[model samples]
Target: MTMGFNESQSAFAAALLDPGLPLPQGITTARGVTDPLRFAVYRNNVYVGLTTALGQRFPVTKRLVGSEFFAGMARTYAADHKPATPLIIHYGDDFPDFIAAFPPAASLAYLPDVARIEVAWTRAYHAADRLPLDVAKIAAVPPERIAEMSLVPHPSAGLVRSDFPAGTIWSAHQGEAVAPVTEWRAEAVLVVRPAMHVEIRFLPPGDAAFAACLLEGTTLGTAAQKAFAAAPDFDFGSALIGLVGLGAFSAFEAFEGKLP
Candidate 1:
């Protein structure tokens, strides 16, 4: 049957990533013959390119599972999940969730969270550049008005809270030899590109809660209270200063007071 340009394009795209689908209608070589062997070669290259992109984006996840294993798994994913955007960098945004449900990776429960951190890191790297809020502005706020103020999270800021020690595992993979994750407790991580480089920080549960609240536009007082509730020993003053230093906030918003 004859197909329009859009229909032809859709068929070609669907068949490109899926080997089971036959070649689109009217597709022929220079000799005007439909060659399944030649088409298969082109299809293989597409899958290989996609698998390589996934490997680059999720290096730690690739390392956790050996190269061969990763290649096989990545190929499986590439077959089922085609890139929605032309930009390869954004191709694997949902890869973490895919890993979570992948039967081969079920034994490594932390693998999904580790992939999540990698995804967050990639996003932080590509986020729009924004000048971080100056630390002095936050400090100059009147103590009484602190409760009414909310800090604006930077465009590059991301939080990853994991039930496993995923942050520790990710950090350990940064070196040549993977360091042993001695502590297996739940971990929360802050991924932000506040300056020239992206910073990956492992945060305490309280600090993570506080950052999450602030990122959601919660008032400073409420965020602090939540932090305290999460961990009684939460240090409000130090955490506030630490986040500021990390450039987590790009600006501040006051409900009823003027800016400093």
Candidate 2:
């Protein structure tokens, strides 16, 4: 009869997910009828809600794979992964990794990275608000110490690096596909919410290295040097302009005694 609280809960959860499972002993309607069909309605509702949440979070994945494939995939995903937290919005946190391991999706190697970018985009959208970097703060630092300074990234700053042209695939699915992705080169993606809207951007050859170094609290000189070594044609002045344009840095501080 599953009289214990813990055992009853386990039985109910299992039945709720699998309508074919018999209702646990001692559960009945007001009329004392054990109609297992009743549980099927709620089971369908739960899957529908969870699948909708996944669709919202990974719209690009849905678009690339088409609705039929995505729906089948989402249903399979829902059966195995239930939300532990009350907030279902965060349910698909491991969906990307799941896609990477799923046998049917083996052909779509970029799917995981695309999922990662979508996750980053949503996270950036919900990140805490913060003021952009005050350019005046850096101006106050002595010019000699500028190279030794470390800049703080904005609260919404996030990055995704993928070997499989993930950024290109993501961009292709954005609003009617402006252009095709002819070149299949590895790309690093930068995500930041400078204002209200989340912005996704692709980093140029050396910019990823520069941005990554800075993200790790590297001195400006070291980041630049590493970036330059990787791509001799790296443009420091242009990169600074782009960084300011994206409002990537939130603050600046002196980094003592550092070189690379």
Model 1, range 75-178, lDDT digits (tens) per residue? 98988899989999998999999999999999999999999999999999999999998888878888888888899889999999999999999989999997
Report model 2's TM-score to 2 decimal places: 0.82
In order, what lDDT does every prediction score? 0.92, 0.83
In candidate 1 the C-alpha lDDT for residue 177 amounts to 91
Worst 10 residues of 2 by lDDT: 251-260
Q: What does candidate 2's lDDT look like per residue over 65-130, in tens digits? A: 888888888888988887888977678888999899988999999999999999888888888898
Could you tell me every candidate's TM-score relative to the true structure? 0.94, 0.82
Give the runs in model 1 whose Cα sits over 4 Å from its true position.
255-260
How far out, in Å, is residue 79 in model 1? 1.9
